[model samples]
Target: MFKCFYPDQYLDSTYQINFEQLYAKGFRGILFDIDNTLVPHGAPADERAKALFARLKELGFGYCFVSNNKKDRVEPFCEETGGCCVYKAGKPSPKGYQKAMELLGTERKNTLFIGDQLFTDIYGAKKAGLFCILVKPIHPKEEIQIVLKRYLEKIVLFFYQKQKKEGNS
Candidate 1:
């Protein structure tokens, strides 16, 4: 079952994922995890973040933030990004992911869920029948559960990286 619990796809870093690159792959919508995926946990957006969101909008790709965090934690960021936010989402559950798709008015086939956790972000997106993009956490201390998850992640990522390299070869 452990092998059954692995992510569908992986990325070296969230920053390296350009909307244009993904657009070429036929992904038109993006659902982002708030903490770690966009910014460090409990951290606010910097100037670069504002610019990034602007570019995402310019690309005409639908994007939204789906976070398991409370409204207090998610609202401000959504406002800052000018994107919709689904709070108290309970990731790995597909509820938030579904809501995001509704907000974007798109189907799962055109969507990409990007986040730092395999269990929540990746699994939930997979369950929702959307493509998943696994990104490294910006900060380990953002959530207590992340500390343990990160440990497990190290092992999973090793094999993931090897497979990716082999695929390229």
Candidate 2:
């Protein structure tokens, strides 16, 4: 019933994903959410993010940040991380994800997305016909709306876990 919101993969952290394996599997591009996915919400890109981007470049992958934030916030972080971005992305809408795929020059078949939220991030990727990875939020503190969503996410996740245990994934 709620299958549309289920992620292709769910993990504890974005940093734990194996980009090399994805590359080996013929995935050439990645789209990312900026906030709690990579850092605490609103915090600037840190050294770890920069290093991850560096490793991605070393692996010959094309990548970009698909963020809902305005240019003021997304630009400097992309600049610091040596990555590109599509700001004000209006996620869960196909246009922004399409724009990002265009920016990376990747087709949906070869592109992947990693993010921290189900409603915005995972749903956006799924709607765009891209593989999606859902990572747990990096921090406990979040805006009230997100906290509210987390409660609902738990219900979906419970079903997701049950499905996984059944080998449906």
Candidate 3:
């Protein structure tokens, strides 16, 4: 029942993801969520994010930022990173994900989505038939709405972990 919220993979952070390995695994495009995924919510693009984008390009990966935030929040970051972006993305809805794939010029099977939220990022990407990766949030502090969502996310994650353990066993 909570399958829609399950991430295909979970990693410690976006920095920890092996882009080269994903490239080898046939994922040609990557769609990233900005707030808390690439940086803390409302934070600017950091050196690490810039370096990661450089590495992704070096590895022949196509990438774009897909964010639910308004243009004011997303534009400067994209400009700093030189990445295409879809702002106010309305995630968990397939429209933004499809638009991201179109921007990357990749088919669904070849696209991957990475974000810190399951309900928004993973669910939306999976719904769009793209592989999903969930990363730990960059900071524990969040807006009240996100804080509330995190409480519910913990319950979903509990079941997700149980299922993973059972599958392995």
Per-candidate clash tally: 0, 0, 0
TM-scores, one per candidate = 0.89, 0.98, 0.97
Tens-digit lDDT string for candidate 3 (23-117): 98999999999989989989999999999998888899988899999999988999988768999899989899899888889999899999999
Task: Give the backbone clash total of model 3.
Answer: 0
lDDT of 2 by residue, 2-49 (tens): 788999999999999999899999999999998999999989989999
TM-score of decoy 1? 0.89
Instruction: Give Cα-based local distance difference scores for all models.
Output: 0.81, 0.93, 0.91
Query: Which is the winner by lDDT between candidate 2 and candidate 3?
Result: 2
Which runs in model 2 stand beyond 4 Å of their true positions?
Answer: none
lDDT of 2 at 148: 98
Pairs with steric clashes in candidate 1: none
- What does the lDDT read for residue 141 in candidate 2? 84
lDDT pick, better of 1 and 2: 2
lDDT string for model 1 (26-50, tens) is: 8878999978887888888767678
RMSD of each candidate relative to the true structure = 2.2, 0.8, 1.2
Better of 1 and 3 by lDDT: 3
Winner by lDDT = 2
